[model samples]
Target: MTLTHRLLSPLIVALAFSAPVVTHAATDPSFVLTATSKNFDNYFPSYLANGYFSTMTSVRGSEANLAYMVAFMDYAKDDIARPAAIPGWSGIDYSTGKSTAGEFWLNRTLLSDKAFSDYQQTLDMHNGTLTTRYRYTDDSQKSTRIEITTFVSQADTHLAATRITITPEFDGSVQLSFPLNIWAPHQPRFPIGKMTGDEMLAAVAANNMSVTEPVNYRTADRAPVWYHGDTNVSNDDGSTKDLTLQLDGKAEQGLHMAEAAAIELPKGIKPSDITLDKSTYQLALNMKVPVHKGHAYSFTKYVAMSRESWGGDASATAALAKKARSTGFDKLLAAHQTAWHTLWQSDIVIDGDAKVQQAVHSDLYYLLSNSTSGTAWPMGACALTPNYAGHAFWDSDSWVFPALLLLHPDRAKPIVMFRHRTMQPARERAIQYGAKGTMYPWEADPETGIDYTPHFAYGVFREIHVNADVAIAQWQYYLASGDSAWLKANGWPVIKEVADFWVSRVSYDKANDRYEILHVTSPDEAYDDVPNDSFTNAAARKALDIATAAATKVGASPDPQWADISKKMYIPFDAKARRHLDFDASVPHDKITWMGSSLAWLMYPNLDLPMSPEIRKNDFDFQLEELKVHGNDPNEMMMVMLATAAAEVGDGKTAGEWLQRNLVGFLKPPYNVRSETASNNAGYILATSAGFVQSLVYGLSGLRIDDNGLTEAYAPALPPTWKSLTLKHITFRGKRYDITVDRDAAGNAKLTRKAL
Candidate 1:
């Protein structure tokens, strides 16, 4: 069952998906990809969320030349009503790290400006690399071909670079037009806002849409001139971000460059203009170059999309990007390759199954691409997708935090620290929302950890359990890192603030003689304003306990409220069914069709509620029924939990079944899209991967972090179908450990540690 490695896309890929699943290196080896597209899509899967560019195409890998950046503003974090009235743009990210929202200045066609035919495209993804090749014919029936390689700068977290090679069949000129489009962010009627069609038009006419003024790009004093500007961007949810974009290309020596108005270009007047009006978003850059039949033209474009709040001068940043491009592309690529190697070196390794290993690595690759060290932008729900105004969601604390905690704690710290930094806004919101202490936002981001979840969804109003989830992540971080220094400095304060929030957020019910959370959305999110949900209540109770324990550990007094609330918190129990109900029994719990495994969360990660084996079985049986009714494989985040539960209860067969279903259903057989929902692709990066890895470590292998190095409560029950299960080089508190579980009558498994 040993696996062999193979070369892919100029590097060694250790696994494959074909029969037997392992092979030696090949010149043209298969790739483990996020899927390359034939056409450009805003939501196309990206190669490296680690960089600041999107490399997605539709059916055939076509650039289509559209760009959007993510940035955040300090204006209003929780103000969604009449968002168009906001004055400035505040957003985050443009393929690299968080930047100010700026215009991408899309071009209609570059290099091949005229009508062409027989278009052909090819794309490849190896690990996290995406390469796209395009070919077409110009209006004169002359053949043209180009290859573009895009990557976020590993050397610089906020830069992206592309190397383009052009080859033509005829000696013709290449002209590019930077025409303002109907859909770029600069347009007033851009569909990024909540209002669409007539409503959007009305908003735009009223000058209240999330739009930037038409600011034409300008040229700096260098060839492949650096052009950058700032513009206002708004979202429906009270967000105003000033984003900036940069475009600087180094063309061949025999090329000529000119800039003019899009309308003037039609007249072919060759206007002598080097500057543009601030009101013109569409400015054209024309390049005329000599082409020989067999010679190829090559150039590199360096770009940086930044936001005002990011604090870096966009113009200077753009200029720096261009300067870096002056160096050979191979040099930049070597640094980038080293970065990926470092990430992979620190990753969790799986042995015995090459296909399963590749799938795991794919999940991990997206995780690394989407998160970086010291960047406050936790992997947003959709990683880089524009949802919740590009804000980090609760998915961060619960899903993203744990996996990075186990493998890349450096990246995981930002997830937890973001809560700490945003606590002030959270507390202010708590007071504003008529609650106590710091209540973390569901759609949290920079500017403030403000709530960006829409009001209609009931998440902002009632899904208050996110506070506890934040605390849970903090607790897990401490356990993994044993960083008491960090605990005293940052972790404890957050624990205290959140614990204070939950204590004041809960209410005492004189009628029932218990503590209850009312008008709340449970983690399932399918139902709203439910009372006394077992998941939420249990989580709240755990939050209090964590706060108190953390306070004591930090030489502070434990909060008395924590004990009082947790002791009396109401948990919806089903006496007849021998399990827990979705909500309080008195609230018609039987009538509700809950859609997730939040209760299962209480069993695995939180373990807030005490349960017997039979009770666990009954709970799981009911959850199976819920999945039968509504859990769509493409979007659901519970298969990992089910597998964890199965492993927790010592059901090896069931655990293996759940794992196989996830591999086949989610990653390979049915839909390998990684994500089905655009609402927040963070689920793809965090929920899917974290849950899978957590199930293996904490579920099947029964591994739990303790003060005494590594410990396991139950011998891992390896499924008969698997030859063995092994994890290599997992980091905890600056140390690395490896574990292997082999199926034998004695249940032989081994754990080893690196010497300090």
Candidate 2:
């Protein structure tokens, strides 16, 4: 087998979403943001991302989302989201465990005022590179321009470096203050980072961050300067004075945070020169570089962010930042950019449609930034964002993984590898649940594999299909990578444990020969703990089939019952509705709606059952009608899944519309995607990016793979308005290829390729 796989499609090509709701709504959109024509001022973002970690700036042009220094904040500290626990760090004293709770939030503004909210700012982002032009005023009424160029270090996945060039119009120095976190207006707890003086101060000095770059410090070069604020600042919104550590007795409360800070600055700019006052909890940065008027003096800083929730100590994280700074920002930035450029092997060219092209590029950018070849830990459900606490959920396996597998299977490998690494916890959880096999947590973080869903939270905890999700992902990885060795070494163990869980979990009825899963939550959370969910049953059965087949392929001993159970699994369907039953035939399908209730995933991404145009149409119609009442908050994935289903029904117009609906509203300026209002929420954009590409793969292109190889290929669902759609540098199995469809009256649209 030379891996010469091809899917024949119409000689034409075209493509596609993520969203948060603000007061912005418009008619059907014709364009999305692109590389050149964006106003970065609206969002104030630029990044250095490496799948699991990102070092970024907020709209106000200050450091944000790194270790989530603060949770959700606003001018009024009324309601704030609590901190979540990363591997080395924990969330702000939370109790529950699901993404909604006990998740780290990374939202903070080192300097914010209602007045500065409208300051002049410009940002330019392309792939892993970002340049921010921030213009603000100082106390001397001098216009200060902060040019912050940021990139996540590819050489060190744990660090992101920023080069700050500041040119002040006058000779006066500005004072930077750290304020108590403000509460969000809409919700009691906004999904943001939160840290008081003690935690922030201890985090730096406890880990020796102050000396992380002493050499750089001594030479009048750049050094990392750290800051943790005191809770007793005079100003509530952090707009006023104070950098001197207040020796007034209260400083002892933070005495333990006694080490130096990790805030990076130029060597000539010493803290003692600018120290007005400081408390152990909170301190300010006040430095004058003799930086008088007109000279642009730039300082670079590095921050180390681990993939785990938190590092064991400060040095573990600070040393990483120090090494990156030592490497110099230019070298790290170039390496980061080059690393991203190399991995951007697969791309789509939508000729004559810049918005679609830019949207696709933006989607691909996030997917690329949030992933690499060997680890799944950083590609959290909300990668590098504090909102989801950098946790992996079913989203990795179901939504994000499949798309990566299509174009970059190598990048998708860590999903399987990470799961294998965490299987022991699954086994332990299975034991706790009194089940025979592994039970994967619905929301996973490295600190504790124990299900983080709040205890007794039946809705997500009862969602046993997470185990099946991992199994399917393993099988899919094997199919895509064709790595038999990996299958034996890592894949088999997970599949076997999943099998152990399923066989024990399934209830066999003596009166009937069918096996059924009981009291389980399928994709639809609305129908919590329902029996025989169509997707769940079908997935378990497929898992069994994959396990048995994979065992033989990899020369492993098989469980005889695996085949029997898969063969006898019961999947309920409604003949009258002509759609798979939400629970059983008795339950009204119209009453259910969730991310999974869109129902087309089983046919497209899951490939659990074959669906013809008629069935696919019927299901899509049923979901739309049902959703009029039962719909949950509009999600990015649901929109993408519906697009997939729509394209399957030969409705490229409908498919394109579904994706556009998200792009116009869900995405902000510069095309950043939001997922369920979480931080770094960009990972949610994977759905839109994957939807566009997968709609081509599974919808328009009708691509499929099985043991026999290239099992199915059909015509493309090219939108009438587009000129062409191309997926180049597609890595399928061990071979590289391209898929292109062009709008033409004549000439073949075959993709001819060798190497790139």
Summing lDDT over every window of 10 consecutive residues in candidate 2, give the lowest-scoring window: 1-10
lDDT of 1 by residue, 108-217 (tens): 23333233233333222233444545555433345556555556665666555555566766663443322211122222222222322344223323442233544111
Candidate 2 lDDT: 0.53
Q: Looking at model 1, report the run of 10 residues with the lowest lDDT sum.
A: 1-10
Best by TM-score: 1
Q: After superposition, how far is residue 218 of candidate 2 from its true place, in Å?
A: 53
Residue 204 error, candidate 1, Å:
19
Can you write out model 2's per-residue Cα lDDT over 1-756, one digit (the tens) per residue?
000000000011011212211111331122223222123223424344666444444544444333322111111232121122121110111001113222221123223332132333322233354554445543323455656555665555656655667666666443332211221212222211244323423332433444555321112111011111121122211112222111111111211111111234565664334433333333333343355677676665455543223232344544555556567767777786566556655666665565666666666667777776654342555454443334566767876787788688877787778788888889988898889778898766533343444222335657777788889889888888788888899999999999989998999977888898888776766676678888888888888888898889888888999999988998887788677666776555555243436465566665546666677678788676666667744455567677777766667678778766656544545445543311113233344555555665666555666676544444456666766677778776788777666654553233223454
What TM-score would each prediction reach against the true structure?
0.75, 0.73
